[model samples]
Target chain A: MNEIKIFSPATVANVACGFDVLGFCLDSVGDHMVIRKVEKKGIHISHIEGFDLPYETELNVAGVSALAMYNTLDLDFGFEIEIYKKIKPGSGIGSSAASAVGSVFGMNELLGRPFNKTQLTAFAIQGEALASKCEHADNLAPALFGGFTLVKSISPLKILDLPSPDGLYATIIHPQIEIKTSESRAILPTEVPLNKAIEQWANLGSLVHALHTNDFELIGDALNDVIIEPYRSQLIPEFKLVKEAALQAGALGVGISGSGPSIFSLSQGLDTANTVKEAIASVYKNTEIVFEIHVSKINTQGVKILK
Target chain B: MNEIKIFSPATVANVACGFDVLGFCLDSVGDHMVIRKVEKKGIHISHIEGFDLPYETELNVAGVSALAMYNTLDLDFGFEIEIYKKIKPGSGIGSSAASAVGSVFGMNELLGRPFNKTQLTAFAIQGEALASKCEHADNLAPALFGGFTLVKSISPLKILDLPSPDGLYATIIHPQIEIKTSESRAILPTEVPLNKAIEQWANLGSLVHALHTNDFELIGDALNDVIIEPYRSQLIPEFKLVKEAALQAGALGVGISGSGPSIFSLSQGLDTANTVKEAIASVYKNTEIVFEIHVSKINTQGVKILK
Candidate 1:
């Protein structure tokens, strides 16, 4: 009960139609972490492997998120965290969210689950905000709660869990390039055409309906990003080409995963997802940018305990 | 089968957050029309009752919509429409939609159902444009397809039918004031803040989810219209006061039904809907404008055949 080992998952926010409010979790792609009650009075980073992230408690997402949760509970004993990173930071597939959620999820487990999922999300967002320079629960909600999630509102923090239809798979292509979330967000226009806004919301509403009905054609039709993609795609090289290739290769839909540098294509099955991945990989191979492709089923379980 | 007498229900479009794409049909508040196949080669308006309207095929919405269907059919026999009007035009409660839908629905039945709901929506929209000067399917979709409907796209004409939770009721207040739909639409800004757009889409996405899951509290929270209501409310007198009163009376949410002068409140049950109606009626009582209130259950059947 004093120690816990967990696997925190990566997530894809902005599922094309929902810009800052919707996200889905990814299976088989995540970071492993181990946390145990220590004699120290505060959160401590015992070991870090793979990724070269900050070790400072205030600087790192894991340390900061864990501290956010720890500060609330005036417990006597402290917890020590050891992270084995697999997902790279800034890949736009919720690498930071995995760290943010891992610490809180594991700590909560070690503490006999004091806080609920909503509270865990609240704590996780504090660290996620450090990465994006803005508060967004899209990735944090999915990474914490699993499957598809709609960050319905931020003020009262209402997160709606949505169903992920069977056979749905995601193909993520992470280009080895730096695209700061803040800079990418800054490029977006403060105002959007009212017509475009209507179009975007219509697509988002339909996408939610399609998910519930399990209509793949409707899902493909609703996977349009007319508002943010036009602007954010400019930061990722060959985004248009990659998206076109993915669509041509039978992906249900394609868009930048988050702030980008990573592109995600959603398909009906693993075969179509793999086809989309190979098509996207070929597009990147011709370019000077290095990229990694991962195909995974939509993760229904958010964070899992590592046995 | 050669003759049809039908009751076409009124609808509340703009169901708060959905703006141009969402609507729900209303029970018992509509118009009745009798359509029959005649030897004439074109549409004929045989009689008009309860309201003053043009009998000219092109000038009348019922005649115009029926003609639109007839033109495409190229049938040997034409149809005659007799309107027993109950809903007043410019009431902001889909009065025009009732007429537009009635004729097309009746004619389709007389022809043994040649056109589907989408085609009926298409033909009905042509007549509806005579009143609104725009082709919006929010009201038309619900009036034709019944229950809650989302007009997800305009060009391709994608209409998604959504479930109406049990006990859902609508309270509509129509103030005797003149507000043109075109003018009401003109007052809105061409652009909206991106943040506001994001908030709107989030609410809309949540609303869609709420409909699917039958979550009433979430429906209340998600029935927020930040993008369109602000500008359009100025056209209606005491809109804010009426909305506040309805909410205070336990109504789930309130918004301008379609454009202006008429406001609709959705409540959990018939009792709450009656309470909301009384509350809204009280607000308009102090003002100089005359008003009428109608409370009804959410109509799952759009257009019903009269026995």
Candidate 2:
């Protein structure tokens, strides 16, 4: 392992109705890390490109994941990592997930890829726990494997691969606003209403079915979130207006991405995809939260080593 | 238009965790109905065969469904009908569904097949209301379209086709004891614990994924009913012993069939299936009820018209 160049993708956590249990990978919006083996027994970091992200080992999410992977495995080799943070921090997308997944995925290659994708997810989750306290595998699985994925059983962390529906396009609008993950989660009640939870599950079951059979209409109908979204939507300014506009513009379904101010809508074609973006942007008159519109397919590959 | 012969198969409702939303058709065990235009203005019912079924039109489920279909559509066709009941009444396996589907389906042919499958399901549900009070489509959809099916957004009754999983076999043991459907339903609470419902939904989501991907192991893992089964199992005399024995015999999961006096266990293969059947039978040493075992595949077709 002389010079290792690894790429880790961005992830979307708290995926709509799935909350802690479901998510898929996004290929275009992600971060990359290039790590080179060094002679020293300690780690070194550099910010090569993209955003001027934190490079301190303790401050950086990628650095934390990389350090944890090395320490937990008892590896003696030190690494110098260069991160290209394409995903903006606090975007409600798993911005840190790219760092966490990229670091652990890159570190595994440096250690001769001892851990498989599922095992690597655990390492990435360890780093995520540092920030969220709860270890979520929803974002990590998609960040690792891409496509539509379900964390069916979590005790042993059983990962079920879901089919990526054909002719499906995701239109994400990142409204440049600051809503911390903690604050968004804080608005949600510790305990949810019983009837609301059942409806959530029913919708979830239908969603899983729609993904499996690639039924776009069914997928649209099943993307409802009753448990967290109702309470959490209040934290995001213009959430309802944005959602209505996006849907009226031909988005099949729209909801908060992860725990957000960032919102995403599912569309069948690029035309509707573009319409969804413009519709969301029209509502944000107060702040220039730098809304980025992404129209892409489900990324079926999680973490990849570039070189 | 001439002599019309159509088959609507029997279905399994409340499929473990799916309760109201999930059901599938059984190919072998169902009602057989045949309808021919008699050139009259009234439906003349005759030739009722198989099982212990009544010849009276008012008491017959199939006759009721046919009457509803004829009245709702205002079809002016006099029909001669033959009914053969295979799925026994009070067996917990959607017995009334077989008759209800058969009646509407057979009459539709007699009326020149005016309705589509979903439309037919709507008419059949009207017949089911006579028996169950509430309108449920889970049994009717699968009974019409063979294979695993989902009744989603059930108020409007949206039917979805689910993939039939591989390596799945059912070991069903019917203890010849009488338990009325109304009596069984009376024992269940109108409401359930919130957490238990979530667990049920989680299992249901996993079950849908399992069917989509043909994951038999996961199907077994997901065949749990946290709410209805626990309370209803008390009604079945040998529920625990049969379940324990079936699991011991390598069956993946076991639960009450429909409203039970009947117990069914799901297994991976023929060897395990036979063992499961024998295990359930052994527990009824002193009981007067004779146990019958069925080792069968999931019936895709709901009802049939055997000449």
Candidate 3:
């Protein structure tokens, strides 16, 4: 039985107006996995190295996803899997997605990579579905194909990798507060105002244009999220102050990243990036939430097997 | 006084879901105006060629516009204007916009180009207000800037000239039928469905992206008008067949051009352009409405004063 090892990058979901439709990978934030072929008739799962993951297949997001693929394809291969959880769970980053994607990628490699990227993405999304109890692809997309991506459609899951815009930097602030995906999803209203929806689309359209053209000014102009940001922002403490401070500190723009508790600011230069970090750190001064700041570049390559 | 010969190109307005906020110019189809300085106190306008236009200052669309500019700026420059109207009235090809923009540009040149493009655009929109009875910047924008444009806001009327996407061609079909702007405006519902609005925005956003990227496939996919098209398409004869034929003929897409009777097809290349034109022209084989077919490149330069 040969052993296979793979690494899948971290992802950010619910990118502004895209909600469940858009996401991207982060080369700096991700996880690793290992899969070993076995002669035992079924799959064996072990939760190792600080994952708090259960050994049961039904409860195991990664294991269940691997099993789903096997059942759907009626494959007879038995396997054992282990995951190295790096990104903390409940951090508003795609912590679960890293596990699910790592598992899919690792299993595919163990099985000789028969399935393509799209197929792998579908399997990874199934794993995400087990964890969140909702079929979501926003996180799985970037986890599969790195870089800024738009899920044009979900029926067949048509994903597109946008051009890597230059002169743009990202600063993410992760505050130590738990925000469940279910809770975040529940808070969104099923209906939005017509005028506001128009504005949201306009901004989103402008954002896509800005990324393609590498127009920082347009990107700044389009960062506004009128539909979800205004309503969900209340969940995060100091949301207003953080955004104001980041903008004041020379960020081209700032907004709530994915769900609440964690926020990100976009800067055009290094000086602005530092200012954004300082601004966010200052906002968390009075609270003991324990915050961490990441000054990273947009990851164009998502998940890669590292030894 | 010097005779200033200025030409205002014909324009395509209400670009897809942009409704009243987007437009672009056409090169071959437009109106020509000759403005000669006269020793007079008020502007005089005469329809010299083609269609009949009003001669009285208050009744004439061009004269009223020129008078408005003069009265607003408190300038006492007088001129004699002759309009060569190539774009017919009520053809939905921005016929009156040519007159209004012609007046504004002609007057600006007569006044030594004092007002910039933006200022002239404002005056041109004001003229359209009298014609449409509702303030819209779609037609006037393209008339001023000559290429693809986005009207970001209408409160103070913010206009943006979008990139003229490459490898894209336009096949405009003006069905010789009169559908009044007043009637078209009246049919639109004051309230829109929330979900429909979101879809509209999504399409609008994707359309903008397609334009910026010059992705003709995406442009074709994004040229839908679910909310407005379905309802307004009822007014055009052989609308369904025309659209189907255009799409079948390899047009990236097809849609009503600015509150039609007039329909326009967008193609990716010259072959597709000819195919789309033939497809559209074939539908009018037995219809009484005379159709004028125009194969056009996106006009990057709007109104030019050709001496």
Candidate 4:
């Protein structure tokens, strides 16, 4: 098997109350990458498809992640890569993570799977860091390992795969607008009030407990972000209206996906997910902003090898 | 039944990582309250034993809590209560909570158990507020419900009873020193760094996951307090030394139990709990500060009714 193709799913990070520590994968809308062994000792992007992205190895997340994995192994072999992007960049839906994770996952498979999921995540993070300017596994971990993932600690890179409750569905709306991840992040306050911080942690703890116990009402009650959302939501158009509509349509919770321009809602079943999707779209219907909505179940299978 | 007796166990609040939100009950140390029906229209404390406590129902935590319950129910009858205190107050353990919980639990039983555990916790908090001047249910919730408890929210009172993993043991060291709860609480910073707050919430989320999943190593790694413990540890005698010795003795984690003077360590089994107890005692062997050590399993039965 000298060639391999892998698909990495899009992910939602900072899930409401969990700021930088929690995320989960989406079943659809991701990036596909194909890797083939080369004679040279370095990675190269031989071809690109579906989206306009930098073909330079260092500039691209997929190429950078693949190069990092190859350099770490210090192998005499290399790979030629091709990326078919489906999840658009600047969508705030973990587009970079899909690219980075797909690259390393394909490389690992080509290299006879030398590294475990956690190790693959580290290499993927290195790739993602080149784009995001910081190391965070909230997106990469779920993209690599599938399902809901918790980045417990980033120092030594500890990741825990959390249990996704039954009947959980995701409804996402991507408006045709772009907000840079760096800019969205810069808008946040460096310091939060101590009381709000306490409330945030309490909700976070409750959220985790609710997930484990499968308490839907508790999940709805705990899906509050008292600190980040209040500030970041300003950057997104129609954020409040969309959220209110989603909630009115039976979404258990709704919040901005990643940073902005994209919003996601969680529902208990397929019918509610579709209802939420329509509700979110109805807010943008009369407006000039063009939007796309996707309804999916919680992605249990994260990144997968296609060939 | 006209007369009822109940024992409410002592609890350790905060649990290192979950400040103001998490706590667990202890088995042996508690307060026993006996309540008998009277023809009067109000609650009363007829007798007190083993502690220098006020007989006035309004001033005492036990009496205050019972009175709160009675007032909430608009009861036509009243009860005379007798208290036999075992857990000493101002021990940095939930001594006051034991009293508060014991009184309400006994009254609930004598009233034919009308209110549920969560309702009982609210009454217990009312009782505790008479002493602490604040409503915190970290200790009271665990004492009322037994085992590990998470006070998810204070208003509209949300208490979650967490699972206690098998083989989990607790070792507590109570140095004969008094650190007023108000004083200890006052020493903490009103504002915490956002970075430290993020780290704390991450550890808290991980700790709850560890409890539900029965991951001991994760529990040890996640049982870190970056906010309150640093400042409050100064109030305890040989706090650092005792914590170091506990860790050296194979204890999974060690920190201040509630506020100061009493430090507790969590271990995986009976042997490690005993070893941790001895290691903690060795730190104060030459000092004049008299201390008491108790080692026991996680108390599964919080407050129990004894007829």
Candidate 5:
């Protein structure tokens, strides 16, 4: 097929206790894109809708990622991208990651799947960098490989896909506030107490075990962030109230989604996820903050081809 | 059964990147203890062999642990423990843990098994604190729960049992130098760089995944210590040379076990573990410091009753 239409989903990165290393895909919200072969040589963002984004090839997240992949291959023809952006930018739920992954995923499909998931993630990270200001594969890996993805290392770019337990779901709340990735990152201390770091890694290690064994209680206990959240949570409105509300409503765990103006709660089932969504929204509604919430299952398939 | 004879195996704690939280049991060497019920109402350290350790019930490692557990119960009879210590004290391979585990395990057997593994670990930590100057379940958990254990939380004492992949073996080298756990701990920085902490948790998370999937190559790559080893390895004699030798001889990964003085290398199979033992021994042979080496399989069973 010369043309492909795909659904590139949003993701929750910096998963509690796993800042900059862990993430999972979302099935509840995403962006749709159509990529097709064009007669000319380079790259083009032919059409766009839903959100205002940079149209220039190098300037746009999708265009930049597609260009990165295109540069790797010596292709005769060019490709054109049509975007239907749905996930809001600066929502902290991997809006840029969706845009980035969509481009290369669609192109790789057109190219008869020349690149592997990790390579596609590398290309997607180039685009992701435009948004996050630093190279991180936490969001991109899950967006490409689906389920839970761990960025084992960054230099050589090692990505590990972890299990998504059955019935696991996520409830995300975007409070319609702006928190830049760089700004959020800036507030974090350059150094953390060694004891706190030990606690963080311990939780992260146990979280992986919880996932593999399908232990929801262990997941709840392990989803603690000792180092990053205490600092960054200050930027979000009513962060503590939202987390407490989510947990009180029976969410397995709750934390800031990424570099948030957004927060996410993970629950064992869709029912609890919906409950958690309503719970967090109730907390946000009391405040002056405008918020939107969505409950989605952990997307096991990552970026998918639309019917 | 009024009397129980047991072999409480050694363990490698602070497993590489898993400082203060992770550990695995070993089968090569350990300590044997015979604990019997006495008509007296207090813990008694009746016999001591091999090591010139204190026989006072309160000061002894095994006795302290037995007292901790004994205090939790309202029992009439007390315990008498006879220790035949084989794993050298200050070897950094859970010598204290084995002794700590042995008393409680044998007593629990005589008392018809009252405590769970986590509870057992908690009591053992009391004894372990006497050695490390801190309460750590890293070594104790593995000895009680078997295989690998992650001390997810220290206060509430949460231990998550991790898998032992088939054919996994350990080669431990005790360089016959003294590095007390408290002194080794004192050398580490109170704080760590945020980036280094992130790298640590990333490796630990991946290491957990590797254990579950039985991915040996991933195990090799993920068995890295970014935070603790750099500081503690300085205290060990020829630490760099030993690690290089282990890796050069096909060991999966090498690091200072628990604290320093003893270095451990993990390999994929029995043959590689043996080879790693030889290589590290060769490196130590050139040094003025004396050394001893032992190669053992991953002990899936923590404390075993002598058949």
Candidate 6:
């Protein structure tokens, strides 16, 4: 296939207890990208919709990712990319990851599927690094491979796609306020207390176990972020009240998605998910900030070719 | 039904990547306790073997654990306990946990199985606290519940028993050196760098996922302990050499068991386990320190009534 269109799902990184290592894909919000083989041997961004992202090959995430794949494969052919962004940038829901993953994934298919998921993720990570200044696969891994993904090591690039429990729903509320990922990251403590670190690992281990065993209650109990959320949550307006409301409305656990402004909660059913959404909305009803709420089951199909 | 004899298996706390939170039970090396009903309204230690343990009800781990159970139940009858210790104290395995768990577990059975595993773990933690000055269930949880266990929280105690993959072998080498648990713990940094902590959680999250999915290679890659091993491994003699040798000889991963002096390696089969045992022994062959090696599968039945 000389031309291909791919859709990559939004991802929730950090996943409450698992900071910098855990992430899962969402079904509803994502980015769409189309890549077509060009006669010229250079990458180009032809068009961008919904957001004013960089169109230069080196500046655009999708363009850079496709370029990385092109260079990695030593392809003589060039590709032009067209991006339609549905997931808002700075939404803390892996908007950048969608573009990065979609580009490499689409390019891989255009290049006759020359790269595996891990190799594709490597190129995607290079693209993502342009935005974050550091390479992290927590968001991109899930967006590329689907389900819950754990970035075990970045140097060796170990990514594990974890089992997503049945009946799990993600309730995401994008507060429409942009929180710079860098600023949100800057608020985190450079050094965490040893006791708190222990608690954090315990919670992370328990959360993984819950996913493996499909224990919803254990997942709820383990969805605690003592280290990051305690500091970062202060930046988001009404974070505590919304979280409290979500819990009262039967959310298993709730926390800031990726970096904040967007809060995600895990629930077992649609009813509880809708309830959590309404509860979060009620907190922002009086506020002037426009919010977008999306309730979705986990995106088991991560990045896929649309054409 | 007036008297019962129980055996609680030794446990490997910390489990490499999961510091202060993860542990697994072993088939061999444990403490045995025999408890009998008496007319007196107090707990007593009638006999001790293999070590010079305190005979007082409040000072001894077995005594304190029995007392905790007795107080929790407000039983009308007293009990006398006889201890036979097989796991050497200060060996870095769960020697103290064996006593604490065996005592409470035996008492519970004597009292017609009044407390469940979690409740029994609670009593056991209280008993262990008498020795450690703090309550931690990393050792006690696995000792009480068997297999791999994660203590998610201590306040509202949440423990998860992970599934043990078939054919998994544990090769433990206990060098005849003593490292005080308190001193070992005291040497750890009061705070950890956020980057290292992030790597640690990633390894831990990956390890749990590996266990759930039975991914041996992933488990091998993720069995890294950057936070504790770098600091505590210094307390154990020939730690680096032994670990390297074990890894070269086909061990999945190797690290100091619990606090130190005992180093454990995970292998997929008995052949590799025996090879790892020889590799560890070859490292310490010229040294003056005596060492004991035991290779066994995971103990599924943690504490059992031996009748």
Native contacts kept, each candidate: 0.95, 0.27, 0.25, 0.47, 0.99, 0.96
- Which 10-residue window of candidate 5 chain B scores lowest in summed lDDT? B177-186
lDDT of 2 by residue, B171-239 (tens): 777787888777887887766664566567778888999887777888888888887788899998979
lDDT of candidate 1 at residue A285, scale 0 to 100: 93
Provide the lDDT at A65 for model 6: 78
lDDT of 3 by residue, A66-178 (tens): 87666666556677888788877777678878877777777777778888877887887777888777777778887788777776656656666676576567778888877
Q: Say which prediction, candidate 4 or candidate 6, comes out ahead on TM-score.
A: 4
lDDT per residue as tens, model 3, B61-92: 78877877877776455778898888888888
* lDDT tens digits, residue span A1-307, model 1: 8889999999999888899999999997999999999988898988999989888888889998999999998888899999999999888999999999999999998888889999999998899888777788999999999999999987788899999899999999999999876688689999999999999999999999999999999999999999999999999999999999999999999998988889999999999998888898999899899889999999998998988
The TM-score of chain B in candidate 3 is 0.95
Candidate 6: give the clashing pairs: none
B167-230: candidate 1 lDDT, tens digit per residue:
9999999999999767887899999999999999999999999999999999999999999999
Deviation of model 4 at B231, angstroms? 1.8
TM-score for each of the candidates = 0.99, 0.90, 0.86, 0.97, 0.98, 0.96
* Fnat computed for model 1: 0.95
Best by TM-score: 1
Cα deviation at B73, candidate 3, in Å, is 6.4
Candidate 3 local distance difference test against the native: 0.76
Q: In candidate 5 chain A, where is summed lDDT lowest over 10 consecutive residues?
A: A177-186
**Which rank order by DockQ, best down to worst?**
1, 5, 6, 4, 3, 2
How closely does chain A match the true chain A in each prediction, as TM-score? 0.98, 0.91, 0.92, 0.97, 0.98, 0.97
Selected candidate, larger DockQ, 1 vs 4 = 1
Q: Candidate 6, residues A122-182: lDDT per residue as tens digits?
A: 9999889887788988899999889998888888888888889988999999898877767
Which residue window of length 10 is worst by lDDT in model 6 chain A? A68-77
Better model by DockQ: candidate 2 vs candidate 6: 6
Native contacts present in candidate 4, fraction = 0.47
DockQ each: 0.95, 0.33, 0.36, 0.69, 0.95, 0.87
Question: Candidate 4, residues B126-175: lDDT per residue as tens digits?
Answer: 98998788899999998988889889899979999998898999999999
Task: List where candidate 2 sits over 4 angstroms from the true fold.
Answer: A42-60, A71-74, A178-183, A186-198, A286-293, B1-8, B47-59, B72-74, B110-112, B176-199, B286-290
